[model samples]
Target chain A: MTPSAEDAAAGLQYSRVLDAPPELVFDCFTQPGHLTHFWAPKGASAPTTEILVDLRPGGRFETLIVNDATGATYATRSVFLEVHAPDILAWHEEHTGMTVRVTFTALPGGRTLFSLHQSDIPDQVLRPENRAGFATTLDKLSNYLHHLADGAKQ
Target chain B: MESMLKNRPPGSLDAAFAALADPTRRAILTILADGDATVSDLAAPFAMSLPAVSKHLKVLEASGLISRTRNAQFRPCHLERAALDGVGDWIEDHRRVWDERLDKLDQHLAELQGGKEERDDS
Candidate 1:
């Protein structure tokens, strides 16, 4: 599926079809027990040490991941923006000023098509007055980089 | 994700973030993105004085976001492509982490269903 204009401006989008029902996949995001099982990257663990999931609009959703190789800890403190059970979940990450939206579409065979869209890369860095200019400049910068890369190949 | 980004040399990404925080500095980078510009050319867009613009340029240079040529008469400011790439790297890092996490989720779901199947068989 095509990403929204804002997401296409400066965002990341990912989709995966999982072998689980929509409710089960949704539960994996809202429930702390299920979230802790797979909320971390490889070589890191989301230790069930301090996970708080308040499943409602404006509620808190936090997770702490510890790097196994370096013994470092990364904490995510975000506020839920939308929480529709068995369907859509979205949150605003406090540290990065990014909004993450996840949707679960139930498939025919009881599977779930999970989609994630993350945006607002320039939110924290740019002021409201500068957003349009910043976005346009980012687009220019991307084009310039592409031009440079193309030049380097010759 | 924080740890992964921090694994890079400290202060590089932090400095880029800080450099991009200023509106004027960001505008300056935008100008440089189009083509290299002299200090006078950069200062012409804003009402700020040359020295004021120079101060901002100093910060940008320190952050490695932009560089100035060693030309004595006219040191044109050039956007450091690598530093901007570093900012893009942050997003790339997040994408990679999410990719890995989803893989873990896939495995977790399999294990969970496998257990359910075993329970149903018994």
Candidate 2:
């Protein structure tokens, strides 16, 4: 029952330029071997994992990640809404009722500018005290973007 | 600040989401955002009956989105912006999660590409 307005207000976005070409970057997502190596967050590793990808509109994709420390397992189930090879990927994650879209822009010199957008965030994140922490995160992101831009200039 | 929310009763988040889901309820929150108003003032804006508006207000109040107070005969409802702001924070948390994951992903991609190059050279 997350308010639709909140979803609109809270959509997340980030973009970065990666060293690899678009096709290689795209393959990193579609291929299970590459995905399993990098899909987990910073602290966790995907071990004893199962990944199934159908790679078409309305096709299903799922990943099961196990926490190394606690042995707790988390599963992410999503259905593809759109898939354009080496360019765009969009899916609806069933667990959080969120839609994620990622775009790969091919650049000169085998580099790719990758952009990500996610919307319809779930409700649990709204705990009252987390408000300040949220502001700090945005600051961090702003700094990251500025740093990236500065590096691009240099 | 952590203890501030910890002190609040549980399920406030669920109630807030449920209450805000309705368009009428959201509009009511918007109207109240201007300033506190009596039940009748809020009911006048909508085509629905006063009772219906009251029902929406009741839900909002239960969700901690608004607080009602009585002064003799006037029961004015005040907007609780704090509750809605919590949602904005939650969204920030969502963005951070992806940021952290992508950082890891950046490293992984570097390793994958590096390994491929080494294999090709050999």
Which ranges of candidate 2 are over 4 A from the true structure?
Answer: A1-10, A123-154, B1-85, B115-122
TM-score per model over all chains: 0.56, 0.57
lDDT at B19, model 2: 58
In the range A25-93, model 2's lDDT, one tens digit per residue, is: 888888788887778775566642488889999999888877778878889999998899999998889
Worst 10 residues of 1 chain A by lDDT: A1-10
**Number of the top candidate by lDDT?**
1
lDDT of 1 by residue, A38-136 (tens): 998999888776789999999999989899999899999999988999999989899777778888999987789897756544333322332232233
Model 2: what is its DockQ?
A: 0.15
TM-score of 2: 0.57
Task: Please tell me which predicted candidate would have the highest DockQ against the true structure.
Answer: 2
Chain A TM-scores of each predicted structure, in the order given, are 0.74, 0.75
